[model samples]
Target: MRFGPETWSYASLERVSGQLAGALRSRGVQNGHRIGLFMTNCPAWLAWFFAISRVGGVAVPMNPAYTGTEISSILEVSDLRVLICEDRLASRLDSPPKQPPSVDVLMTSRTLQVNGPAEMIEHAASPDPTAPAVIFFSSGSTGMPKGIVHSGRNLVRIVQTVSMTWPLRSADGLFVAMPLAFVYSSIVECLTAIRVGATVELQERFDPDATVARLAAGKITSMMGVPSMYRMLLATREQPGESGKLRFCATAGETLEPALSHQFGERFSCPLLDFYGLTEAPHIIAHSNPAEILERPLSCGRVLTGVEARVVDDHGQSLPSGETGELVVRAPWMFDGYFRDPTATKAVLKEGWFWTGDLARQDAEEYVYIVERKKELIKRSGFNVFPAEVERVIREVPGIAEVAVVGVADTFLGERVKAWIVPRPGVAVNVEQVLAACRAKLASYKVPDAVEELQELPKGPTGKIARKELRH
Candidate 1:
């Protein structure tokens, strides 16, 4: 893994992880204890992760960008025995008026480097295959943060499934700039590459110019990002010929519309593949075929191997092909359950299936198309309006960088469609143009009743557009 000026081979990572594991055991870390990794994307993050796993500790990765209140709330819910963070962020753990509850030990990058014994080795049995080993927080969550737990074996299975679906070999090099606190970056991209001995270039946070330079110089052969990341990268100016040696680029954590895919492919001369997944099941659960998506727009590809997916009604009865309903899936690598929330767990994990709360449908050929979140379905004038459908149409409008459609209360219409749009930097957006595009492709009721523009939309930890905040 390469991060800034530092590079680490697998051997170096194993040694650092071993040393950290010994230090953790010396500090009383034990089997089943929950530990929080509150840092950005770095080699230290992975080393600490493997170290925690080596000593049989459950690793809880927290978004370093969260506010003090948000961080405090996660701490309360995480049951973390130890919390590790960068020295710069460790001070914030004591943020005034709401200092986070103290864990058994709070280790920072500086402290860990200074205190770790250089020659110590880790000696512990592997964690239970069924026991929770990692807890990844879900996006679009309400109230306190919701962490989805998975066993070590489950993580292995998820990596294997994605690696097979999105083939990568040892010779491949990945450019990873997405947030590592989420599974898409940490497991789907990062761990998946490691599973095949592929090298990676890690970025603490995304910088479009830096990323463009890396791609232009052929520093990496593969890239993975969310739609927003790709949008920003595409917005940056680039020369025509100096493109990355990318065989393919994968995107997830949000809907992948055709307009963006075509623009991205044209800009970088690489095939952009879209995958669908949840925090509960890592990614590449379903992936897109370039030709199939063109033949059937918005298709999220077919269900992957070792996985069963069905679109079902509220009663859990499976709907026929071309029928829209809640998307429920069954997979061997699915998450164990939500951490310490059986009541919430039971609500979604019905019998043996996981209700994905996503409104979607399947074609006769088994191509899956996600419409929107079931909860985000906008009810307008007694007609069901899926926000994603409207948003998809709005995105086709020129100059629109991102858009979020929400349902605002209306005494007469029950809920009126309200669209929040963020235009490309330095570009002027015509609300009339947005409405016209929507009118052309969408039903009258599905078009935005009220339009508002913004510099940017609120995003969840996973980089998916957060409609919950806009609704509030």
Candidate 2:
């Protein structure tokens, strides 16, 4: 039982993917070639992804939200020879980017349609498991997007290990509301479904009510989302019966609030699992299992199988358990490196360990609790306050629906905490009331100095709050 733009079972995926592989082969797409995908979440994206990997072409999935300039930078840097994009998205292209390093483009149907067998999609191509299979981009330290490359073997290991860590079966129908362009959702929801032969329902965009309807209709048995999605869904009784068929729910991309997690468990009667990962090393380096979740409420979970995690200080010395430091992860599914960026890659990938920019502390039981992204720390008057820490506290306010805490320039203090909040519909929330709520839970220095009400909080491509963009 498989579903997407078209009803494709596990067996059908193989047949269509093989045919698509042949189609690309006929179009001269070959081993180690870079093929760009510029469409949103759809069956075509998944099919072409597997098809590219099957024939050893590195699939470079581009963000549709990117501007012509941003898209040109990626195509130029990646030197992509061919791009398969939606017909509608093609209209957004700028002069086909005529530069030194150029790329060609292919247009998929503007709307969802069953792909016909293009005879060229029949040639068998040898696959190199160790060669690059996918290229995902992340904002570089140089203020540009850098392509991160992963191999076929790496993806296979992720599927195998995540399955071992969390038991997912073919009987499960996973509904993923997040964009597949993000490696987190791409692998966990899309690739995992393909690996386990499970059914998948893809939504182009995420709407709280629409997602609930899908869940209530029982079209999906499993779901994965960021914390913001959870908060929105819980605000209203959108889909009353949605939780009945759900076996489990996984939350990632931000810190999971314990209060909200508890509410989710009580309301749905399903355990809310917490997963931790990054774009560079894109799988569950640590995941809280269903049983462990109740005991370790704030923990991301024990280190995943085939993965090892440690906390180390600035000098690279291992920190004692319960002490916070940079997280170092060693996992089987980690990426090779950022494509063509050796310096940036070397900074994170050192001696078989991926130095995650995230800060965390471990307990005696080896459970990991993420403090915050290292860059998100606010140095205010010589005191360090984590924005996530403050945001979590303020979100408990009754009328606050979504909240993002960012550090803004201050005169006396190096930076001041600014809270951008989205109030619940038809509810009036005063800034003073929100500050009072935070004061009860936070230190004096952590209290937000200013509060701004937003119609909606800005989100990055991966669904996390785009605080950097907001700060500007």
Candidate 3:
């Protein structure tokens, strides 16, 4: 694995992971204990993740950009016993009022580097296949993020299935620029490469210039990114050398526009394959077959082996081909459930099928086309941002009377958060103040890109905010 200026072999990585697991055990970490990982993409991130799993503890991967409030909410729900965070990210957890005191903080620089006795300590046995292994928090419609738990067996099955589908050779090198906290990177980039014994080129964060330089140097064979990352890379002047080592470029986390796909393919001389899946399922249900990208440019491609996908209506009845409806999927590697949220879990999962809020249509040829999101979720630059979450944050501002958050189309970010506010009588509210409040309490992406003052918010007959009207 390569991260920035350092590279490590598989043997070295395993040794580090084993030592870290031993260190964690020395600090009272026990099997089935919940551990949080809040750090940027780097070697230590994977080392800590593997260490937690090595000792049979549940790993909770959280976005490093989360603010104190966001992190506190996750801690409240996840019941994390220990949080291994990067030195820089640990400062965000210092806010006294909202800081989680119950959770112990272990700096990655210090904790992960601590060496145990040379005598190797035997790690805990692997948990059952059905045992919860990791919890990935995804934005929920109700403003709080939901922790989706995936079993050890589920993760293994996903990696095995994906390896079979797109068999990566041992010599192949996979580039991972996206954050590992997200399921897309965790499963597709990190675990999949490990399962196939392929090298992984890691980046602390996505930088178009650095990534393009690596591609030009022929350092990576395949890369995975979101739509925004691809766009940035295409905008760069750097071009891949004629070596033709970089073969595949896979995109997920957002709808891949056809124009962007075409431009990327033409510029990089590589197939820009798009995949469709969610944190709940944690694997690509539909993907563009490398060989058939030219034939089916718009389709996300057919479902993979052992995965069932159907377009169903509001009543859960399957729709005919070419009819748009909610996409429901049943897969062997689906998540166990939302951690500590059985009510929310039951709402989406039923009868062994996950009701993906995404709307899609499948053609007669079994190719899937993502239409739109039926849920009130906003995807800004591939990060799920719930409208309610932004609305709730905006409402906390003193000058706001009522607020509504909606996503506006953007050429670069796919969608940008836009807030409309209703000011109280005789009280002046400015965009700067509202944005300042958001920046203090929310992540950078969750902050509204634009704010507009409204005389009064439009409401439906039921006296609720008319979000659809605001979109128009």
Cα RMSD for candidates in order = 10.9, 10.9, 1.9
Q: Return the number of clashes found in candidate 3.
A: 0
| Models ranked on lDDT | 3, 1, 2
lDDT of 2 by residue, 400-456 (tens): 899988888653354778999999999999999998877654546678999999999
Q: Which digits, one per residue and each the tens of the lDDT, describe model 3 over residues 125-170?
A: 5678698999999778888879999998888888888787664777
Itemize residue pairs with steric clashes in candidate 2: 22-121, 23-121
TM-score of each: 0.79, 0.78, 0.95
- The ten-residue window of minimal lDDT in model 2 covers 94-103
Model 3, global lDDT? 0.82
Computed on alpha carbons, the lDDT of every model, listed in order, comes to 0.78, 0.75, 0.82
lDDT of 2 at 192: 82
Question: What ranking of all candidate models by TM-score puts the best one first?
Answer: 3, 1, 2
Winning model by lDDT: 3
* Candidate 3 residue-wise lDDT at 53: 87
Best by TM-score: 3
**Overall local distance difference test of candidate 1:** 0.78
